[model samples]
Target: MKYSIRNILNSRSKANGNFFMEITKILGHKPKNTSIYKKAFTHRSMNIKDSEGNAINYERLEFLGDAMLSAVIASHLYLEVPSGDEGYLTKMRSKVVSREHLNELGKELNLLSLVESKIPSGQFGENIHGNLFEALVGAIFLDRGYKHCEKFIYKRVIIPYVDIETLEGKVISYKSLLIEWCQKEKKTFDYNVYEDTGNDDVRHFSVKLSIDEKVVSKARATSKKKAEEKASKRAFFAFQNRISQFK
Candidate 1:
């Protein structure tokens, strides 16, 4: 067979073209600077660097996107919930942009498929999906501006999921909820977390939630936070009757 150098280059060009189309569809507009979008999907493990020798990855964009989400959501809550006080508005915004919700958003968009990472995508934690989604939003803000970013947030987040009643009951932090309940009733609560690696290859943690020195619940998970949350959730259900009275 004859060597065809041009054929390989053409295939590469076509791949790039398709990637741009995918990004345009997601953003609802053509990206002005393709590099920014690329950076948004680039993982830190990839270890890319700019000509100035600065590390290039989605971390910075994630930070910007988090702020942008908070700002836009805060604005929407302010306007939509006219009677909501500072505490109410803040709580509403947190529910909307919580890590769990962001992870869902990222999964819905399948944003992880575009990430350039040295690590296998399967090995990544659930937060990576949300992290990349935030990076993409940050890229949009940088590439276009705040208006474009706000529009995307409205289309994907606010318009679809910002029902007042739904958000009011949504649990952003089960652990926080459990602690608050305990405090309200003048009960002391503690999360006794300890390492509990079993036969699994990954290390795990176990937690026992004690309320008033009584072990209310015990749970296990890959991380201390997850184990504590699991324990708290169990504890909450166990004390649901009493908690309802305080609520």
Candidate 2:
């Protein structure tokens, strides 16, 4: 069991080789710079730094990937739906790259398994999956350029999930929809949120959605946003016939 720098280098090379294969399968092409891909999955908790003493993590890549995703999706929607106006195109692109949809894509790829983090993966929030997926896109753009990045997005996002008719019907946020409807109908709506004690381990918030000074629906969730959204969904259904008429 004698150890040397050569043995350590060999071990690391073997690990990177396996990683390269995995990335290739995901990208549909070999990555030019494996180190960029490595940085994509490196969590801030690791406190990694480059030789220049600059912090290294996925956050920066996440921002870049978000922009890239938006640009590519917007371009696709623009060409695909020549009839769509600015608002329609914007909404369609949002649906295509929504947090929920991105999370699903990340889960499908199992990208979290590659993360280099000091924190346990289980402790991460649901957004971590989507974050990693975006970071991977940023890495692809940096390593292989926009052509490869656009191709990857088309394969993973546009080809499988994107359908003009389907996306038009998709609701990205019930809360936003509810609010818009309220405003359009000239109805004053309020979300009254308060902490709700529960036997479950997680703290909960209860929300009452009131429209026209009448309590329309009530719901509870671990977060106020979720609680309000749940209540809004219930309220939406409650007034579905009227809302449909407005639309």
lDDT to native, each model: 0.82, 0.83
Question: Per-residue lDDT for 1-247 in model 2, tens only?
Answer: 3223223235568777777899989987788877788889879997866656677789999999999999989988898899999999998888888999899789879998888789998899999999999999999999988977888887777765676755877677779998999999999999999999677678999998899999999988899999998888668756753212112
The TM-scores, one per candidate, come to 0.64, 0.65
Residue 18's lDDT within candidate 2 is 79
lDDT of 1 by residue, 1-247 (tens): 5322234224457756777898999987788987788788878897766656677889999999999999999988897789999999988888899999899789878898888779998899999989988998899899889988888888777765666765887677778887888889999988899999987799999998888998988988999989998788667756643212112
Supply the TM-score for candidate 2. 0.65
- Candidate 2, 149: how far from true, in Å? 1.0
The candidate that wins on lDDT is 2
lDDT, candidate 1, equals: 0.82
How many clashing pairs per prediction, in order?
0, 0
